[model samples]
Target: MIKVLIVDDSALIRSLLKEIISKEPDMMVVGTAPDAYAARDMVNRFTPDVITLDIEMPKVDGITFLDKLMKARPTPVLMISTLTAKGADATLKCLELGAIDYIEKPKIGVTEGIEAYRQIILEKVRTAAVSKVARRTSTPATVKQQSIISGTEKIIAVGASTGGTEAIKAFLLALPANAPAVVITQHMPPGFTRSFAERLNNLCKVNVSEAKGGERLLPGYVYIAPGDIHLGIEKSGADYRTVLIDGDRVSGHKPSVDVLFQTVSKTAGKNAIGIIMTGMGKDGAAGLYDMRQSGAYTIAQDESSCVVFGMPGEAIKLGAAMTVCHLDNIAKTVFDYLNVTGSGSRL
Candidate 1:
């Protein structure tokens, strides 16, 4: 059985989390704590396989606790946060600090919301239990635009889930200022994507922003799919445009990687480059295969470098990936492909 520890400042939240987790047949809540101090004690006694940590607390915040925990024990952590701007920022920091993932507290109907998302919460806990936790690592040297052969017209499409934030950051930070246009779906909720995109924009050379429908795709820019919406690509005259759709969850997620990859295959065809990174499940597997069959270059993040290795592994199994590579090599590989093929140069 999967053992879990709940760390929160609220008795109510702790009880609610326990109730939700206890319903899972494969998992059990080993203990609960109302603060980080109590949580530290529980961690020693329970030795849980996973932890659900709340961001707000009376004394030590979740971020500090996570940093300490990763440095010491390296246990998989899933953060619980309020659906606010500060909460979003803190959650992103937690991810960078080696937390596995996060779930936002409902703003309106707390009970109903928790019940509605029970499955997702359980799935995250299961993924966290089996996740690979390691010390934080930095990206390699910055990308040089001049070194990349000019006139590569490639449009890159990427999809990720579980452990994607850090993976995507490393890939983008290594891109040149004139890198090809890129679009992504990272399986985040609304209100969080804007903060994520803004954070990426501040850190990376590429101009990254949350996608708003109808924007023309351009080089040197990366558009991230907004939460709770589906983002697609379409051919418009001599250029490509972003299409945002609000529909039922495809592959159990809004802004699914499958949706993005399918759209890219249909719209950009051989001009696109598809990449599936570290994530849980097979959301992008078949769509990536379509991209490969349509003559686009496809790559998967290799198993050793993946946090979960589910999505990319499925893609590799399905013959969707033309090549599988480490996270550090992905940027250079994409650039090398651009240098050689120049797929989108004439478009």
Candidate 2:
């Protein structure tokens, strides 16, 4: 059974979360607390498998407490965050501080969407229970071995979920400033993708921003698919441009990785590089296989470096990846793949 603890200032939120978690046959709510102080006591007594931590509380905010918990005990934590710009930034901080994942906190007195909210909460809790927790740390800095890929026409399609916010950041940090055009699809909601792109832009050498369809794909820039719309690429005379596709959810998600990967296969063919990163579920497996079948070079993150290993593992099982790399060496792998001649190869 999975043991859970709920920490929040609001009595209602604590109660609601408990109600949702308690219904699961394999989960038990070990305790509930109104602040970090009480939560610390419960952590000692219950030693729960997962914690649902509220971002905003009366004292000792979520970020500070999360840092403390990671340093002291290192239990898996799932942040309960609002779907606001400030909340997005704070939630990312919690992830950096070692929280396994986050769930959107429901509005006060929420009624109409209670069922959906319960489902999401339980799913996140389940994920958190099995997640690995460790001290706050940065991805190892691996210097770029060379300058840049030879052509602006080469394309990269990256897909991730779960721990991807950091995985994507680590991968992007390795690419050269003038590397090939990259189109990314990460599982996020409507309000967070713009902020996530902005966050990556500030840290990496490459220009990163949310895709606003019709923008021409170019080297030195990375475009992230907007939260709800699937991102695709198509020819615009001689150059390629972003396209916001409207369709039913593919592989259990909007802005699905499968859509982006398959789209790249159809449009760029062998000129594309497909990367399946750390994530939950099998969203990108079939599409990644399609890319490999179409002669595009494909890579999957190795298990030791993955937060979940589900997505990349699926792709590997399907015989999709041409190369399997650790997260730190992915950019180096890309550099080795795209030699100076501009025709791709693998090391």
- Candidate 1 TM-score to native: 0.95
Distance from true position, residue 5, model 2, in Å? 0.7
In order, how many clashes per candidate?
2, 0
Candidate 2 per-residue C-alpha lDDT over 1-347 given as tens digits, one digit per residue, 9 for 90 to 100: 99999999999999888888898899999999999999999999999999999999887998999988888899889999988889988998888787888999888776998888888888878877765663445755644546444465789999998888888988888777778889999999886899999999998888999999999888879999998899989988877899999899999999999999998999988889999998889999999999999989999999888777889999999999999998888888887877653654221
Q: What's the C-alpha lDDT at position 146 in model 2?
A: 60
Model 1, C-alpha of 46: deviation from truth (Å): 2.2
- List model 1 lDDT by residue over 5-123, tens digit each: 99988887788789889988899999999988999989989899999999988889889999888887889999998877788899999999999998766343455555567877888
Could you tell me every candidate's TM-score relative to the true structure?
A: 0.95, 0.95
Off by over 4 Å in 1: 106-110, 145-152, 343-347
TM-score of 2: 0.95
